[model samples]
Target: MKNVSTREPGLHKGVLYAMLAAALFGASTPFAKVFVGQVAPVSLAGVLYLGSGVGLLACFLVRALVQRGQVGQPVALTKPDLPWLAGAIAAGGVAGPVLLMVGLSMMPASSASLLLNMEGVLTAMLAWFVCKENFDRRIFIGMLLIVAAGALLSWEQVPVLGVPWGAFAILGACLCWAIDNNLTRKVSASDPLQIAMVKGLVAGIVNIAIALAFGYALPGAGTALAAGAVGFCGYGLSLVMFVLALRHLGTARTGAYFSAAPFVGAAISLIMLAEAPGATFWIAAALMGGGIWLHLTESHGHEHEHEAMEHLHAHSHDGHHQHEHDFEWDGSEPHAHPHQHVPQRHAHPHYPDIHHRHRH
Candidate 1:
């Protein structure tokens, strides 16, 4: 029997990654809202994602130069990873942002940001039922709380932009991203930066083409640059961190933690725009915060069996890792290489991590 003992380390680390991704992406919402005045909605979406793609591509180029002869490139994406990446770009990059930008154009940033929690609920549901990711009842309860919070955000006395159309647009955006989240999981083992960059590039190009077809004039360079900067942090860096969390936490859990993003955006929007949050906002915040706490503190422990598995990612010689090398190992504690997990049964706390996906 093998054990990846001390579940706190992995759980805490994955939570940290998810929160950071949330913060980055959430903060981008209000900022993107502000930029809506500077360009067409679709154009702004394109630029933001374009910036993310270009910035990450540059980082990857530098990384390659620095590790030209490295024995392992943990951040490299292969051909097998492309299909998932394409779907993520199409759903998340292209459709999601266009809907979000259009929604932001009509709704208050605070309201829009709060409504964005829908993505987590949708993502979790898809992961739990559709993807067949193993999870317990607690996750479902947390999902309900998040869904309730999202519903609260959609309450408007009078729906502008065509009778609650804005709120509906944001919900549509959430669905697109939910699909993207599931698709991205298929390639989560690959380099996250590479996946994000490709998604950004393809999505940016598609959205930009659509916007140009609509006859939106190019915005000033300053506006374009600012949107790009937002994209680099909110989309590029956030996605890289998100993929890291996904590798450790699985799709549903990762989305649950990422529910924190909209809160960050709401706080920033209130401060930046001097808008007030009403009763519904505070109520929704409490529900979401509670749900996020539940996911964060969760620890799944059971005597689960590990089927013989072979894959590669960043790792150390934890108890669960008991593989001999085909080549001379560099004798490092933590390294990335092809290793196999012999069948084992042990009782320990775990998540549905890359190694721990077993029947519950």
Candidate 2:
């Protein structure tokens, strides 16, 4: 097995990246909501996604050019990887943002913020089932609590008419993201930047086309600038961070940490939109906070094991023989010592004077 310590520093890095990504993602909702009021949802969504896609693509292109004359060739995209890439674009790039923008337009920022929590539950379930990852009873219970909290937080805000479609669209967005997470995992061995760029470019084109077809009206100068900024921070930077997180944290943990985004968004909405949250919102936030704590704490066991291993060493010596043993002999005087050996485990204190028989 790969050493956990070696993996842990990266995981810590991933956690930091994931948290920042969640914060950026959360901030985007309020900003997007601001634009949704002034511009057609589809048009704004199109520009946001397209701009993010183009930004990522440009970064990828620049990197590729820089590395063209390097030792190893630039990472190549294979035919087999296309389907996964396509799926990520369709779900994360195209559908998720489009639905999110539309939903924000129709729903109150607070309600929409709460509804966004469903993404984590959906993502965790899909990753657990489809990706065949480990999901213990605790994780399952935590997920249920999160779902329950979401329902409670948004219960009163659920619309009575034309709401089902919007709800369905939002749910579909979650599913798309779930699919995107798993698909991205399948191709995680490649350079994350390259994968992100491809998904962004392809999905951006498709979303823009769809937006235009749906008769989305273009926004004015200020709205356009705001939308672009939101897209760059939320879509572009967030994705890059997410991809990096996935490298160490894997989909399940990544989803768990990302569950905070909605709550963060809700807070942002409350501040920026001057929206007042009810008692239920506070309760839900507490539950979500507990969930995050549990998720982060669960990794302590792994860290403990790693720490223990780093400080200990094992060696072999013969108690029966006075001198170094070369070979095994049956109860004979002046018996030959059959074997002499020393072994060292890295990242542990060495015992120079101690020698003992190898234990089975």
Candidate 3:
């Protein structure tokens, strides 16, 4: 049997991360829209991602310098983490955007925007079915509503499935991102900055290189800077928060929480543009609000058993981790190291967070 516990402090932190990620990403939407015609789509995407990498790398460098000579700091990204990180970067960074640009060229803007909404849906599906993230009916309904809000915001009578190759390409982008999301979770326990920085740099470089190979010229300096700024927020910071959320909330729940991004983006666009929103906008807003509330209010609990397990990630001396050390031991909290879990059984409220991933 599997038990769900919502009483953990980690889930609260996860919700905060998820919402913050949504806000940053949502706000970046309109900013990125400003760069659409000013630069080639693929080339601009590369710049944005490059900006994210550079910005985060700079932050990481500064932090390391400040912490210079500090011992016992957590080392990030073990040899085992490489394969997962590489796959995430390749799928989400390189292939996803490239496919999106291809699809956009073939389809109408309205259709493309609508199709982009599928990313959330696909993310949830992959989290639920493939990754075995747990969710009850309320959570599922919340996801559906948030996804609906996205559809409403992008709605333009774009036929749901009438498009051919173009639609397939767009859908491919969604799947790639979904896969990337799941794979990233496999390494979420690592330092988020390291994971995000590496992903941004590799993906950005690969994309830029491919674009240059095809003779895509770089945009003007001002436009490039703008794209990079947007990328820093939308892609870079958002990913950092998202990884943190995964560490707390698992995959499917995080995906559902992220589905509220479109609504946030739409609201921000309306404010920035000083344009009046239609009834549909208000309706979508209400629905999304309700959905987020459902998620926030959820309480999942059951009796479950923990099989003995062992792994490495950042952690503190919580109830779940009460083991001793082999070599020297320090009192520093939330540090990373290899650890083991002995078999135990308990009953409580929970989410399918990293520690509670028992089969139902």
Clash totals for all candidate models:
0, 11, 6
Best by lDDT: 3
- lDDT on C-alpha atoms for all candidate structures: 0.81, 0.63, 0.86
Q: Which stretches of candidate 1 lie over 4 Å from their true place?
A: 1-6, 9-11, 98-116, 150-172, 274-281
Local accuracy of candidate 3 as per-residue lDDT tens digits, 217-333: 888888888888889999899999999999888888888888888888888989999999999999999888988889999988777788899998877777678799886766877
Angstrom error at residue 322, model 3: 0.8
Q: TM-score of each candidate? A: 0.88, 0.71, 0.94
Which residue pairs does candidate 3 place in steric collision?
Answer: 4-349, 4-350, 5-349, 5-350, 6-349, 6-350
Candidate 1 on 39-97: residue-level lDDT in tens?
77788778888899899999989998997876666646667778878888888888888
Candidate 2: residue 298 lDDT (0-100): 51
Per residue, candidate 2 scores C-alpha lDDT tens digits across 64-103 of: 7886755334345666778887888778878787887676
